[model samples]
Target: MNINKLIRIFFLLIISSIEIGQSLVPVERHGHSAVLVDKKLYFFGGESVFGKLKNSIHLDQILYIDLSKPFNTANPPFEEVINAPMPFGSSYATAFLSPQKKNIIYLFGGIMWDVNANVDKFKSILYSYNVETNEWIPPATTGIAPEKRREINGVINNETGKFYAFSGLDTNAQNVVTTFNDMNILDINSLTWSKGSITNAPLPRVDYTATLLSNGIIVFIGGRETNNLVSVDINQLPLYDTKVDRWSTMTARGVTLENRNSHSAILTSDEKIIVFGGNKDDIATPVLNPLAVLNTKVVPYEWSVPTPAPPLPLTTNLHSATLVENYMFINFGQVHPKNDSLLQKPFFYILDVRNFTWVEKFEPEQLSQSPNGTTTVNTSSTNSPGLGVTTPDNGKQIGIIIGAVGISVGVIAVAGLLGYKYYKKQKYTRAIPTAGSPTI
Candidate 1:
């Protein structure tokens, strides 16, 4: 082919090779905590890339996005709230919105760097932020706080104004000290910390999700022990009764899920626990089936895989999943922990749990309303729901395609001009005769 044609083809190929990365551009973070308050979504500390450093560093600032506003997925409008009274950078922390005080959010334990000692330490302190004022309240405590730990799991009993913390990984300067199966209860009303019963508690585990059901029972699923080994069976899950301060186990029936850690789980208004994305054998190997549903309304809790599951090869771990109405928002995590190229891609996904479909954008107003005033959803096909992949706004894609074509045209024009000049020079050289030959 001609040089100009080859140039156009080469540029087009280059454009085609570029992967369409995530439309959302929140800072790449995992092991962070996210909570939905009113129409606002706020996220706290997590492990993130810092400058030229190859290793991930903990973040201290809090960032948020308003769900009421329309935003382009390619460039989400996220506002960062820095300069707050953040004591330290942290990761694998737990955060929940206070039920009594709707405007206040409580942040719990996580791993933070001890700047003075130049070592990693588990945070046992509690920090509260007032959303209305955008200020942190000074932590005042009357009771003993829990031991410093990270990768802990906790959930709030909204009715009682209590935060129940489960077992967590305890670490010191060098390595993991131990994983505790004990429980800690924090009273939001009194700002006090007290211990819970350890009798019949599940094995010392870390990186699990504790989801509180409507009946006031906390369900613990999929976590690993201190040696990074997962022994919890899906058939028999652990349970904690906050009402009685007791622990027990429940045998589930239905599809089984392999043991996993560092996953995210959220309870729906209808009493369904949606568990998604976790690490399997190791951080490098992610769980094959990233999504599962547990129906708590049934006598024996039933477990089932979502119909038309999320797009295949959806590897995620150490991610944060927050539920807002009928939609679940999964934030950044290690998509492919070892693969740098895949890890660089932004990890943000929205799932319409109403129909178990993946959606590209978030539109809260699109919820259908029934005649009486309740929100209506599609529930006809429970087992065979088709994948509803919401097509993102094509404005950005169209612009990129047009820009690519324009660049290709410019390349072709330059290549054609250069080729023409070279051809003319070659013709002139060929037309010249040798010293011993007749001129052409």
Candidate 2:
């Protein structure tokens, strides 16, 4: 080979290495998890098809957005936090900030692909990520972890320092194994896992919202059961008393909502549980009532639609919603499009829960100096006298669960085979159709 040709080849290799090292922005996806800490949003595993790619793959990078900075929706400022010991790629996982440790976030079960086995499996292990240290911590626990599952919901009791994980679906090799209606408790202080014996638990379900109230009661909202049935009646809300280790139900006295699953719910300072977008049926149709509220402050509880609904950009489901003071930041998910040309993209929107309206940008409340000369967040304007779930005394919001639900065994087997075929070919001409859940 000529000397000039060899030099050109060396330069090309260097360019390829540089491109490989560059971090790319996260793509639009569903069935992921997110948690907020110190005004920053950290995102984890979800499935998305890469640019011009035929099939979807589990995202492996950890992406986050700094809320303090200004950026456009078309191009948000998302930075990737790369770690060598990071967890494997998975979907339908749930995550929450530690109640005992403000800087740490905990991730629970989800569906992970087993490369060696060439099949999908549940992630049974628990993992923690430290935001301050920018590293993933090896989970050390004394007791047996919860059974392998996905689409499970959990909430942390700020007073007890215990995380209560609820119902989820378990599958193996595209076959439905079990749909659990059990509870597993993890003591955040000791990191010990134990079974929760609660009376009158509801049926096996997935993709629900578990909101921990200030009074130690966890409210379970809409989700889909094993038989593809959804809890649509706003009149009935499942209530679990973490203090008593018992379960009960409450009936609200106002407007009812449509059947929905994979929705996001946030508790306002006024004791209102605001529910956002979700799928309405087994076919994965977007719910008609995109936003509604359940006022826990009122006796018997009451449901009502906001007098004037906010103009939403799209109908979304399987998205992550993180509450920061009075603003609810809605993250990426599948959008049920009326126009077929509308493509899914990595984007977010802010809903001002104070008045139930959408805002173009988020302006965090300013910090003020106290009489002792210590800086404090000025939340007086956003604060109201009511009993509901908010950032606990430890400064960590209760875990918000958002994910997809598998419909049945036949559907799962078909979807799994289709997915495997796509994986082998590495390309496809059209998007895979999903029924209430992503293709396995």
User: Against the true structure, whose TM-score is highest?
Assistant: 2
Candidate 1 lDDT (Cα, whole model)? Answer: 0.71
Off by over 4 Å in 2: 1-25, 50-56, 83-85, 114-123, 229-234, 307-310, 337-343, 371-374, 378-440
Which ranges in model 1 have alpha carbons more than 4 Å from their true place? 1-24, 50-56, 114-124, 309-313, 366-440
**What's the true lDDT of residue 172 in model 1?**
63
Give the per-residue lDDT digits (tens) of candidate 2, residues 252-271. 78887786888888777667
Residue-level lDDT for 196 in candidate 2? 73
- Determine the C-alpha RMSD for candidate 2 after optimal superposition of all C-alphas: 19.4
- Residue pairs of candidate 1 with colliding backbone atoms: 23-73
lDDT against the true structure, each candidate: 0.71, 0.69
